[model samples]
Target: MASPAPTSAPTTAERIRSACARSGGAMLAVEGLDPTTTPVHHLLDDGSFAITVPCDGSLVATVVSAGNAGVQAVLEMTDYAPLPLREPVRSLVWIQGRLRDVPIGEVPALLDLIASTEPNPALLQVNSGSSQGEGDTRLALMRLEIESVVVADATGAESVALSALLGARPDPFCGMESCWLQHMESAHRDVVDRLAARLPASLRRGRVRPLGLDRYGVQLRVEGADGDHDVRLPFAHPVDDVTGLSQAIRVLMGCPFLNGLRARGA
Candidate 1:
């Protein structure tokens, strides 16, 4: 079979934003420090990231000692497949920036601000403290002034500008993407096989698994003897809601009438 022609796809910035939004937390890698996992983090609108760490943690001390100079850091966010696959990692996003600690006095205001947009119980945990143990697990606020953004996924790795990343919006259906892909993998194997027909013969030889979905299209992961290969099957047009997504998937299955029925379902 011939390879399918490419269609409009999400830009690097859009993908970066979406990945960060969907990723609940990230692995924090700072210069001169061992990598640590962050349980609560949020990407601010201004392209900066707000993260929480224990007030008494080594990371907090390191950033505070740096003072206003700030320290270089990178937050690695991983996007995993919703279903069981040979390669579970779907994508990797690196958010590089300078890390600084928000002042104790200013922490409340920052949490409040973040809560207004992206609310998380962790934010509250930062205030009241978590567990009472030998070590104080109370979290403190820290900010990463984003300098660069890069996303490596089925599509590939590309550097995204801070301005473009700030402007780009995450896919509206990103939150539900995992569930949809899970459904396709579990109950709609036939549809997946049909869609695999669109891939090149070389890719078809491998196990074609549903990898991801977005407003633009669906992605497939081809697991073969050599390694894993990612391919995308673009939708005829972008979809916003479930109805449009249903129509697009049906059309991809070469069923135009199903698209009509999906839209008419009131």
Candidate 2:
């Protein structure tokens, strides 16, 4: 037998695209305090990325990139506060970079350095022998819920749409299991409403039974002559929220393995 042709290694972009496809859709759970906010969840598609502390009165930076040879990211300083736009006296050359890596404890010095750069006028004045540290520390806390879906088309135009729908990289910490369930309930309600809107006359004529919620999630059973189809919708936010749920419904409706139930009939 002849030797097989060598396989080419996937390019970074190809790897990213494949990861995005595998992700299908995902929700993020984010949390942090003042200046810098760390996205707790690691996105499957991209290596570790983080959101920098707000500067120039903004809460976030537009562009974020992974750290060099590490599971961390550096905030592109220029995006949030450009040098030309800086107010000379107030801006002390704001060159301190923001970086975060997984197993976060590894960079204690870096963390402290970044934390020091936070807008702490009280601390600055106290060190300068001008004021005490009694002034309020302006800390902003928020929980952001993000859902991402990949839309690849032949024309490559869908990438733009997908990016638009997904928006900027979300804080991963936002998609905690508890938060995920909450979002899932919201999604379930939305889906059920859509299905109800397209209810078939025949089914509407039949008895409508309400199924109660359970530990796993909610279930709604509908009886029909062909057979009873139990429509069980899992309320756990899928890896990728929208695409995962959409694919699940499509599978349930299309598969002969599953009871042929038209969740939304034509």
Candidate 3:
């Protein structure tokens, strides 16, 4: 994880970039085009992602007729907490854009860009020559030129400017967020139990789960008679490293083992 922005909510660009880094797939919906789901993808530095579809697919045919085929379609990408919790999806980014067919000459450069960043093993299937590659002719790459984006989560929904998303950086923990969070949920039950004891009495009806952890705070989800309620416990200050993160989490959790009693004012 990285430190929160000094003052304002993270730039719309930051959130969008982080969400894209966290997303593996997105739903592509356009009028007169069947929703397409192909995995050979890339999210360029410019805040656009390319999805390869079969040559005969309606999406490509739509593109053949209209240069701005994507202007009316929606490309929805979502990020979910790597671990199980009362609420699994942490954020969603809905991108609306103009879709375009990758020119033949641009495909090589585009594929190179995608390969360098996305290490999806399935990419091994993209062979340009007819010698040994199968399914090459059936595939065509299309790019979504993002015009607008909407990021929604437990925090709420907000529109992010295309420029901001393209300029922002993803969380440092983006790659390992899932693994660490899953470890916390599975290997740290005692810690969760201790944290649960601190929840407001009214919300202790069912279960308490660690919802998320970021430089700014720790989130908890409590299942109650009515439904689930989420609470964010802000750290005293922003944390930029694992040591700081550990100390902050300990302080927030009241350092149960350090003393017989919870810390004062914790």
Best by TM-score: 1
lDDT tens digits by residue: candidate 2, 1-266: 99764322322233233233222122222223233432121222222222222222233222222333222222211111111111111111011122432233433432334345332222222112334346423221112222222232212322222243234343222223234434434555554444433445555443333332222233344456654443444433333354454454444343333334454653
The parts of candidate 2 lying over 4 Å away from their true place are 1-67, 70-162, 166-198, 205-266
RMSD of 2: 19.6
Error of 3 at 19 (Å): 2.3
Q: Which stretches in model 1 have alpha-carbon errors above 4 Å?
A: 1-7, 130-136, 154-156, 259-266
lDDT of each: 0.83, 0.30, 0.71
Best by lDDT: 1
CA shift of 176, model 2, Å:
17
**Against the hidden reference, what TM-scores do the models get?**
0.87, 0.18, 0.79
Model 3 error, position 6 (Å): 5.7
- Candidate that beats the other on lDDT, 1 or 2, i.e. the better one: 1
lDDT of 1 at 254: 83
Comparing 1 and 3 on TM-score, the stronger one: 1
Cand. 3 TM to true fold: 0.79
Kindly state the number of residue pairs that clash in model 2.
14
lDDT of 3 by residue, 44-118 (tens): 877677776656567777886777544466877777867666668878778888888777788778777787877
